[model samples]
Target: MTDDSAALWVNGSVARLQGMPDDERLLDTLRWRLGLKGTKEGCRTGDCGACTVLVDGKSTLSCLTLTREVEGGSVTTIDGASDDPELKRVSAAFTAAEALQCGYCTPGFVVALAGLLKERGRSAPVEELMDGLQGNLCRCTGYAAIARAVALAREDAP
Candidate 1:
């Protein structure tokens, strides 16, 4: 197969990457090539959500997303989200609520929560919040803290 090259905005910088295989997953490219390790690899499939990232401001499974597909698009990993005020609020809420335990799933949860709040609004109902978070799985911490974190973030969101 022939290798291709693509340019994408990652974090806050534009990255020009080369020698990409057609099937190269976004997670692999981010972690191995771009050196963004915060997006973890869990199930490899889309189910785990451990490799969650924001593509054009939407939460996406990097493991299932092809690198070439994201060409010329914006990709935001946990590293990038860390600097976002909205995501910072979410992170503070997560910390205040003690929402994470093992922390392997924290990045996914954070990205997912950001997407949820962005889509559903800050005052969305509890059921809606729960539904929004269904894509992510956290084995160590029960969802109660996470739910509380969302509520906290809602209270603080503009």
Candidate 2:
């Protein structure tokens, strides 16, 4: 490892990174380097949203994002969202709706829903809601519970 270094704000805290490989993905940095494992790596490609995280409060695929791209930017993982009131509501909604089976994809769904709510407001239409969540895939829990969780979160949103 050379003197390559990059710094970014992660989960509201500044992360000073050094000696990172050029090909390292954001997911790898978050999980291995930062020890934030809530962001899962489902597919290495961008097909699966399991590695979703909020970059500057917008939903982004960590697997597809390179570590260097996050330099000077802000990242919010599921662990970070746990401190947010809005996301707390979403998490409660997920629980009430029983939206998770193995819980592998739950963090991605929560991050996506939080991004959607922030972008479209709490009164987003059903069509928009469906579109916003289309990127995520859950094999065991199915989509019904997830949709219900979104609805519940919307209703609970202030």
Model 2 lDDT vs. the true structure? Answer: 0.87
TM-score of each: 0.93, 0.93
**Number of clashes found in candidate 2:** 0
Each prediction's whole-model lDDT (CA): 0.85, 0.87
- lDDT per residue for candidate 1 within 3-105, as digits (tens), equals 4557889987998888777888999999999999999999997997889988988899999999888889988888886677767788888899998888999
Q: Residue 49 of candidate 1: its Cα lDDT?
A: 88
Candidate 1, clashing residue pairs? none
The residue-by-residue lDDT of candidate 2 on 1-158, one tens digit each, is: 43456888998899988888878899999999999999999987998799999898899999999878778899988988678766778888899999899999999999999889888988899679879999998968578998889888889442
Give the Å shift of residue 55 in candidate 2: 0.2
Candidate 1, overall lDDT? 0.85
Highest TM-score among the candidates is held by which one?
A: 2
